[model samples]
Target: MVKVLLILLVIYSFSYGKIITGNWSDPVTPIMADYVKRLIHKAETENAEAVILTIDTPGGLDTAMRDVIKTFMGTDIPVIVYVYPPGARAASAGAIITISADIAAMAPSTNIGSASPVQMGGRDIEETMKKKVINDMVAFVKGIAKDKGRNEEVIVKMVTESLNLTAEEAQKQKVIDVIAENINDLINKVDGKKIEKNGKEIVLNLKDREIKKVEKSLKEKILTILTNPTVAYLLLMIGFYGIFFELYNPGSLIPGILGTISLLLALYSLNIISINWLGLLLILAGILFFILEVVTPTFGALAISGVIAILFGSIILIDPDSPYGDIPLQIIIPVVLFSALFFISIAYLGLKAQRRKTPTGSEGMIGMIGKAETDIDPEGKVFVSGELWNAYSDEPIKKGEKVKVISMEGLQLKVERVKDGSKI
Candidate 1:
């Protein structure tokens, strides 16, 4: 009985070695970096055999990519970067991360490479800066390749020449360890692979291991939404519109509240994503020009310039090479046109309002025709603006006669007898 119990306990203890698995299907942002860090920490705490991250990205921010690579390389547990799904391609930063993994892998029909760095908007940097960036990226990839025992020459070519390769081609070049059909296949292929960690050999025994799938936490999901570039851009535009409307019609609680919230959120998003200072400045300047147009009535000159500034600003707001990519022109054009129309209409209405005569106050009394309540020789009371006021005129005026208010005086109105007086 004692021996049977001992044997059962041993079998139960060794039956399932756990492995952590998750998907990274979006651009690498600060939020994503924090997520990966949390996953790594979770895997470490759970004593998992390995972490299997399935990737499908067009690449992302340079700083974020480096942060992810550091997390992978710094961990004791073996980290596998699998370019999964048939149609997936690990380009740019994704390619570099793949080559940096303890076990780089891919699904059938997948491809990797194209690690060249570019500025925001997918444009190359200036020549001198381009060479520096290219050389730096080349060295970075080469070092990662060397450390992971991958083909350094080919990996360097991926940066310098933007070389890309299919799964079979990558395998032929010794760039990946396995071509997997799925997660299960990946596990089986690398089940017995040995990795060096902290000068010690750590063997993966991932066969039939319990797969612990990681899901984003609620906080992570919210942060993900907030960090999205498109969401950020929209928030910024909405913030501006809200604040502008609030200024145009003061005491509008809704616009002020929404504008403050949206502006804060947008600013937070900007902190996480790389942005162009010039683009942000241009956008602000555009809004200022719109306000000036309303205040000064520039005959649409400043309004036109505002439109142009905003258009260009929207085009270049996000970094050209950012993983999220530039804001689509389809969205930009409609937004720009609509915003221009909105502000222009407001400006026109403001100008019109200014031209309108006052309905109350001293200015309202000017040019008004009223009946003289008392006979006057340069001093008398006159009924004006529905009230009898102390009034005086240059010439004598009779009672029950019409008078025209020329101007206002302290507690009085300066008036003149109406020429060809009609009915009061």
Candidate 2:
């Protein structure tokens, strides 16, 4: 009886569908793509009534955008792309993603469009290549618009002429299905709306439904941080410095461990964002120069070269085409300057201090001038280094004569008679 009751309860829970919503505020990177895929999969597993994705992005990598769209299309449940918070935008690739959803929605005062493709550094492609890319993107967007029953003609203008549309304009032009004030308004407006997916019509029953807001998992948050371009570059630098400090002062486990971890995470992040090989090599060369500056000071020559190389390298390290964007000049300039200073000033002094010989141990007894308390031919007791010890000398030392400690053997000191006694 209990087993039967459990099965019925499980069925009852799934019968009343729940809505799954996620906020996407970052650029569409591999991490974002993965998150969207997981979000949709979670909805499918839970048999959700719908999935609402609130997006506010400046577009991102083409590949990541395509992955997100693919994930949305493959799912059986309805996917709604909502441009929310009134001041948000669905610019560039975001426009296409917005239109590709089963139900495209936007909050008041929001806008969408500008889905044109450009080269790295925001430069336009050559005339020949320009047409090819434009045509390709046009067909992709038009196809999606046609499938979603949106206005294909107006939507394609977003690619051809970089046309943008306000929420009201989008709604009027049939570019978007709904203009909602908020999530609740969107739910109430689209409630019982019918949309065709894979040749089957799906009715959205979102009114008064249980809404489950999905947030990034801890692992996802960490990956998101690692994938940031600035953060990744910082991690790389930290790794280098940590390892450098560890090499200078061995057995200081903390720096070495932190450096290793930071470096590995940096490499992993670099893998996700496309990087220029020349830029990376230049940065490495700069690091090498900085290290050389520490080992062999060149009166700022090596340090200057290192700073220049690092600056150029950092400028080009991130691919211009990367959706994650470039490292800010403000960060780069200060970091390069600080790196040069650290390598030359702190590194040199610290290393010198570490290499300096200690003067407090038994070796400190060497070169000390002390008076011989007892006179002897070969071995005599002498006071040196603030203590009395048995001393030996090749020459005879008279009582009360000055002697210099040359070396130490066990508890005794090897001394020599000072003809002209001078305190050392």
Candidate 3:
């Protein structure tokens, strides 16, 4: 009886202890991919029975997505992708990942699909580009489906045709294996299922198992935030303008410093996302043109061209469908318009200031010829407009002889004699 109890205790220990759990929401940035790879390695080294991947994302970087898929495929542990809570979605890359799991499950009110490959900026790709993208995506999803023993044809349809479905429909069509309302239900349903890992079959024993969640590290969190489209765009704009402002008006270090930091952050983000360099160049050109409009009057021609270039460049900067959907047209249109208006206003103000007459010091006093009211010699005192000044003149003049102040040096005024009968 003691031996029996010992055997049961050993069974329970092996069944319940060391369950690994991971969460992925953003369609897997490079940082997230690395994190997941590490977690999988840890699970394998520790001989964890299950690696639970909780998902809630609209999808993300394609390269990162492929990296995650490779990690999942190579792991020697059962990976169960669970779409949790109400209203959660496993769209785009998330759907492909979900289908790649050993066991795919979702909570009530969750969804999956819309696996179309859009332009990097989330707009519809040109026909040629679209064909290449569609073919690649279809091939990828089909491979995942085959590996996980899901329906390849349906996966292809989903990717090529942009099909979406409720969790129930997905499960019914055999595209997904299960549909559980929560983690507990998932645990119960998958408890006795068999999965192959490291070429060996192992049955899951998740009944009463403790679930532990592994979160992204702080570094990963920061990288993920930087990869966001809105944040990335803002950083790019701030960096560009800051540096430009600093260069335009030297000795102001604040803009330069801020610009450097923003640019660095934006570059890091662009490295992670699919960015077209041509679009970046166009944006730079647009800024240069706008600045030229301020420096040299172009009658709004340069400004108009700059605005058009900037708008076009921004629209084409990133392929919306690449992973993160393109920047919404609504968002891009307004930003372009506002940016154009801002630069134009600055140009107009600059032009107005340039055209205005000088208003300070000696420049303001140039045309005001004053009369000397006292006798003037090369070094004599004179009264001009109620102020006494050291006066100098080549011609000797009697007291009260009218003399016109011609120029000034320090506190002295140089004068010329007023001819007889000439206007003083």
TM-score top scorer: 1
Question: What are the models' TM-scores?
Answer: 0.62, 0.60, 0.61
Model 1 residue runs over 4 Å out of place are: 1-16, 272-424
Stretches > 4 Å off in candidate 2: 1-13, 120-123, 233-263, 272-424
* Model 2 residue 271 lDDT score: 73
Candidate 1, residue 25: how far the Cα is off, in Å:
0.4
Per-residue accuracy of model 2 over 249-302 as CA lDDT, tens digit each: 975545664575567567766773333654676688788778877776666666
lDDT of 2 at 397: 85
Which consecutive 10 residues in model 3 have the weakest lDDT in total?
318-327
Regions more than 4 Å wrong, model 3 = 1-16, 272-424
State the C-alpha lDDT per candidate. 0.81, 0.83, 0.75
Tens digit of per-residue lDDT, candidate 1, span 1-424: 9999999999878755589987887776765676788778878877788999999888877888999998987788889999989999899888888888899999989999888898854788899999999988988987887777788888888999899999999988989888999999899899888887667788889987789999875444655687777898999998899899989997544575457556756876778333465467667867876777777776787677678667766775765325474588889889888888888899899989998889888888889989999987889999987898999889999998899999997779999988886546
1-424 per-residue lDDT for model 3 (tens digits) = 9999999999977755567898776755666676677678767767787888889988877887888888888877888999877799998888888888889998878998888887556888889988998998888887778777888887887888888889898898898888897788888889999976657887987777666777875445756787887888999999899999989997455576567557756776778333455457557767876776777656776677677657756665663224463456688778878877888888888889887756545444334445655656566776665677778888876566666666777777777767772434
